[model samples]
Structures are given as C-alpha cells and as structure tokens.
Target: MIDYTKWDEYYDGGFADEEPINNFNEEYDERSELEKLEYGGQKTNVTAKQIMQETGTTAISEKFLYRNGVVIILLDYSKGIFDKWKNGRILHCLGDRTYTTQQNTNGLSIIDRTLFNADSIDKIIVRAFWKDETKKYRLVNGLLVLSKEKPYTIEENGKYRWVFPLSLMSKYNFQMPEKYSYFLDIKSVKEAALINADKEDGVRLTTLNKLARFSSSKNDIHYKRTPQKKIKYTSVQEKIERSSKIAENALILADFKCEINNDHFTFIRKNQNVPYTEAHHLVPLAYSDLFNYSLDVEENIISLCSTCHNQIHYGKDSESLIKKLYANRKELLKEAGIVLSEQELLEMYNNS
Candidate 1:
C-alpha cells in the first residue's frame, strides 16, 4: 500500500519506527531506494525525448525534481510561477490530523502540467505549500479520506467558492514507492503546469471556465450505454423493464467492471507493453435512472478510475456534476465480443 499521507500532507512517519533514521538533512536520492519499492528494484530516469514522442506534448527546457527520483518533464514555462506556496505538515499526533494540498499555477511552466494518459506515475516529487484549513482526514476502511467534502463557504474575490484544501503540490523530493498505490490527481504538460490560477471559481459561473484546463486524467475512461427501446411497452412495469435492459446491457458490454471504482489505469513506464485495464461508468444507478424496478438513464454517466469515480460523484461541480464515460466505443465493443447498433437498441426484438 502506498503511503498517501506522506505525500499528501506533512510526514510524521507513523509513531516513530524502531529504525527512526533522520535523513531530512540528506538529499533526496530516488535511485537508492528502488530496491525497497518494486520487484525489479531499480530507479531510472525518464527522458524528455521519450515523453514528447509518447505523449505528443511539447515541453520547454527546465529542471525540477520528481519523487526524489530523477524525472524528465519538458514544458515551456515562464519564471516564478509557484509564488503562493505555503509550507505545511501532517502531524499524526494522537489519531488523524487535518491537511490539504493545493495546485494552482500562477502560470504553469509546460512540464508542470499533468497530461491525460494511462497509468499513475508514482515517482514524482512535488512541494506542497499549505494553509491552515478547518478540514482534516477521516479514516474509513483503513483509507484516509480527506475533509474535502464538508467544505466551508469562503469569499475569495467578493464571491463564494468552496476552497478545497486538497490540490496538487510541487513534487520536489518524491519519496520512494513503498508497498502502496500512488495517485497523481493533477499534472502538467511537462516539467511545469499550464496555469497557476488559484480558487477554481471566484463568485461567478464565468470564472469556472478558467478551471477547465486542469481536468487532466490518468487514462481515457470506457463505458457503454444500453441499447434503446425496441418494444412498444407502455405500462409502468414496461418502462422499468426497458430501462433495466438498457442499463444492464450497457454494463454487460463493459464486462461489469466499474472503472470508476477500480484502479486508475495501467501502462508501461518504459516500453511498448500495454497495461491491463477495465471499464467504469460515470452515472451510477444509485443516483441515475437505475431504479428499484427499472434502469435509470439520465445524462450523467462516465468511465473513470476508482479514485476519480469517488471524486466526481461525491463532489459538486458548481452548476453540474462532472460525469465520465468511456473514451473508445470500439474498444468497449471489442472487449464485450459482440456488436450493437443504434437501431437495434431502440427497437424491441422478438422471434421473427
């Protein structure tokens, strides 16, 4: 399991282990610790040329730290973008304490922006400047749930914005990957982020547009919807049954693997080898047309990793709920090993 607390907030190292080595003074060397994290046990540097070739994004020349390990992120950026950086620490004192990391580029230095792709790159170092906020962490099922939900209303620029304490911080001295999962909720084009606008929205819907650039996903989502109604069913029972067919059929096509509830994705850190992945739906039956008797189909469904799934439904998107779905329709069909058509979906079928 990845030590998210160490990366997300200040590190106290959980009740002072026996070894208790104080290496804060020592420089962060990523290569040295690979042995403890992975099976192969070797930390390697990612090249800029390789990143550009695979990601199809450009980067300006600049140097930054990743996971305390050496990472290459190329992005065109101006200077002094990370000015609002506030130093913070996560004190595990008695039980769970409170903390939040924010990411808003005064202006992202290209490489700083995270790009949409497959898999989570754990070896990245970022500096997290924090301010004292009222929210903290809640441990559920041995997982640390940030106090992002119960946000207190705040006035930034003469408007109300729910300021979340949690956001992306600079990855300067990335810790070695222990037996844990890592997630990069945010990233940049290359070494730097694309923008530095703090406070996603200031008191108006217009300002919300500014935040659109930050929606970088780790992988393209995948999900399918059930075929349309074919039968002339009219009774309430018929409607319920019809809806169920659509939702169920859609899920059947995706192999019932809730992408929004599973891993972000899989991809080779280096090489052409692809990774394993499944599909997830954005619109869950709990909130959507998924009914006690029928399928719930409204306009809100998406495919996502377990983490993004939790984030999308649990949080409010200001005016609407940000939904996700599969990015590739053909891939979804191929996975299901069957073909469907818009016409077949809409018309009820019976023995000819």
Candidate 2:
C-alpha cells in the first residue's frame, strides 16, 4: 500500500507503489470521457482545455501556452521547496517520463526549444495544482519573469524538471474552491499580478488611499475564522504583501478616526476628504509566520493617528498603547484566527 503521509518518499521513489495506482486507475477508468479529460494524473493534459477556454490562449506546446504576448505554463505541484538564497519559492514541472535508465532526448529538446528561445515572452503565468490532506486538489497561480537559467537536470528517473522561482505578489497564495472544484479564473490571476507590480513601484500611502474607496464596507466584511494555510515563503524582500482593501475597511469601520484617541487630530486628505488616520497592524505583519492565521485581516488592523502610528514603531513607551489596542480587539482578533497575549504583542514590537 502507498503511504500518502510520506509524500517525500513516494515522490522520491518515482511513485512505484502499485496499490494507489491500481486504486486511482480503477476509479479513473469508470469516469465519463468529459470527467476523464477534466481531471487525472500528471501525465494527463487535464487543465489544458480549461485554461484555453478561460484565457483564450493557444497551446504553443503541450505545456507552454501563449495568449496576448504572455506564456502560461501549467505545472503539477511537487513538494514545497524554499530557497533561502533566492528568498522565494521554487516550483517545478516534471520534464518527461523515463524508460529504463535512459532519458528521453526528444522530450528535452522540445521543452528547450519552446521555453529557452522565447525571447519575446517577458512574463510567464504559472498555474500549479497540488492535492491537499483531503485528496482535493488546490490551485496556486502566480505571474513570474522568464528565467534565463537552464532547467535543472536530476539523476533520478522522471525527475528532470523546469523550475520557476516565484516572488509573493498577492496577499493570499492559494485559491480554495467554494465547492470541490479545481478551476481558477485566468483573469483574476492577471489582475492580481498587475496590482502587486503597482504596489512594488508606486508610493505606499498613495496606493492605499486610491484602493480605500473600493474596499468593502463594514457590513460586507466577513472572516473565515480558520487558520490560513501558509505557502512556501516566497517573498523577495522577506515582507508579505498586505491587503490594502482590508486595511481600508478597517479605517472605514473606525470612522477614519484614531482608535487610540477619537479626539486625536489629523488633517483631512484631499482625495477622500476623510481624517488621515493610518491603518496599523497591531500585532505587526512581520510576525505572521509565527501564527497559524493571517495577520492581514481587518480585525488585526487598527486606525491610529500619524503620531500614534509613529509611536508604536519608534517611541520608548509604546507598550501601553499596544495594551489598550490589544484589549479592545482581542475578542475580534480571536474570531479572525489570531490569538496572542498583550505581552507577546509588545515583544513583537520590541524585537522589531
């Protein structure tokens, strides 16, 4: 029997275990033609049609598809590998099947020609799928620059792969289905990439102010109340992207007034003509990896005047302000899957 728990072993061993294959094949063989085309093992072109339909892209190769000057590569997820040197996640697509001891030269040539020589292709969209603990497939989509480096070659059979190093461009990593579905809209992926690029290039405060108007209202905000699954740490700057929309909502819910003191005065902005309180993460986003849940949610964001915001970051006696903020939002934070004591929160600031 294949031990699903030991994915590392199963993957490294070339999936030689017979029981799971027999089981999977048996279940797969009974499905309708449409279902078979829609979902299957890595060898199957399962999501190709879905991608083409969603993006109006044409397949330049079996794995490389082209649409409007962009290349979208569909990859089957291997184990998560974090490259400390790159400070990002490295995801790969298994090259081709191996027969006996020899690698397929034809397969290697095709991949090389398709990807390596594509000078015109500046951006590549990567859509990867991995099965979760429940055996349901989850999807992670990101936009990346085409790497100039050659594909990594492995001595292990069936392990020759093309790897893409990815930087975190969005607040959320994987998109979970509302129902048991594997489809991710292509449009949403592109939009998110543009937003992240803008955030990286534009002024931080200006970007937030522009997006604040589009943020969801207090009544419309909802929390999953469950711990968010962590992606392989893929940040280029070691900083996770914060959701401007969530921060904006927090500011809106606070009536654009300082949570530290409602009487605190700040000049109104010309853009929105509201009080210019800054949205500060009370627990700080730098300590996100320590928690099971996300720190980017509305409940974790506090509206503070410029002075108070600066105080939390620079003042010697900021602990009292943190204590008051924590006390006010502890229950709400708990509901949003963030649980930390006042001392721990204070320590986060101190350490930073």
Instruction: Give candidates' CA RMSD values in order.
Output: 25.4, 20.4
- Cα lDDT tens digits for candidate 1, 1-352: 3333232232322322223223422322332332221111112123434333433434333332232222232211133222221122111111111123223322332223322110122542222211122111111111111121222334344533232222222222332222111121112122221121111111111221222121223243323344332344567445444443333333333433444443445433122122222122222222112122211332222223344434543444411223123233423432332232322211111100
What shift in Å separates residue 207 of candidate 1 from its native position after superposition? 41
Which 10-residue window in model 2 sums to the lowest lDDT? Answer: 34-43
lDDT of 2 by residue, 238-285 (tens): 333346666777888888889999999899876766778887878665
Q: Which ten residues in a row have the lowest lDDT in candidate 1?
A: 136-145
Q: TM per model?
A: 0.18, 0.40
The whole-model lDDT of each prediction reads: 0.26, 0.52
